[model samples]
Target: MWTASAVLPGAGPADWRELRRDGEAAEFHAATEMLELHGAETEAYLHGLTAEIPSLYVIMRETAGECPLEIVQITASPYEAQDYTDSGEEIVEKVPMPHGLVAWVRDFVEEFHQDEIFVKRKRDKKRIDIVEDGVGDPRIDKAADIYASPSLKRRRLQ
Candidate 1:
């Protein structure tokens, strides 16, 4: 998967913004250093990170505020991941970010939102219907179909 990773330096927000928007590719270490010069908050966030998860990627857009940038993280896990592992990243409407970070990201810049990459979910248009070989009772009935229910019965009223 193609990704963009650019660090914002304290020297120039314009350059960082340009790189973020137009650059084909950028490295993290170089970017991290540039951002550190601008804000302690961003520096601290980077310092806290030990390693990057290979499955996820993020594009941090420079905000108008003093902070480094507003970043939106999303998974790049391959389609085949579902075939191998039963447990996979859930289909999420948005990335899960800490409350404090979310607040910070929004505050750092005005109208901060996720920078999305075009990744479409492809599924074969095949209908999955009820198919069975051996069965105890035919479920299709006329009046009512018996579903598993509570055994307790109501008492008769006087």
Candidate 2:
């Protein structure tokens, strides 16, 4: 990968203390050295490149309480988690497994729905008192012209 001609090139043998090489090889070595210098950045970039596709990872994080939870990582997953009890918040249970994950989630959701308290939506109960008057006459009084405005009479263009 690294070449000696790159390290020492056509510059000259004048400076014996320091080695001089071809500028092209030096440039190549410099590029490699620059890449190596940002090892962490390069690794992160490569990781991001590989992470273009959606993946599921169970991330365990310490929460307010003393228990660790499985935080699901997904770009997009149709699974929804719901928790309502002495425990605090809902947890993500959706993760790519061999199988039966959907059934487990469905059972969990069913149990949760059975035990969870759902407050009934309060109806507005608004009173709409529509008073009807005597509306017998369907005939309309109109001007000689149909397009005449109430404020300004229709202008006649000759």
Best by lDDT: 1
lDDT of each: 0.35, 0.31
TM-score of 1: 0.20
In candidate 1, residue 71 scores what lDDT?
43
Off by over 4 Å in 1: 15-57, 60-149
**Residue 56: error of model 1 in Å?**
12
lDDT of 2 at 84: 22
Q: What are the per-residue Cα lDDT tens digits for candidate 2 across 62-91?
A: 345532332222211222112221254433
Q: Report each candidate's C-alpha RMSD, comma-separated, in the order given.
A: 17.6, 23.1
Candidate 1 clashes between residue pairs 3 or more apart in a chain or in different chains: 7-31, 9-34
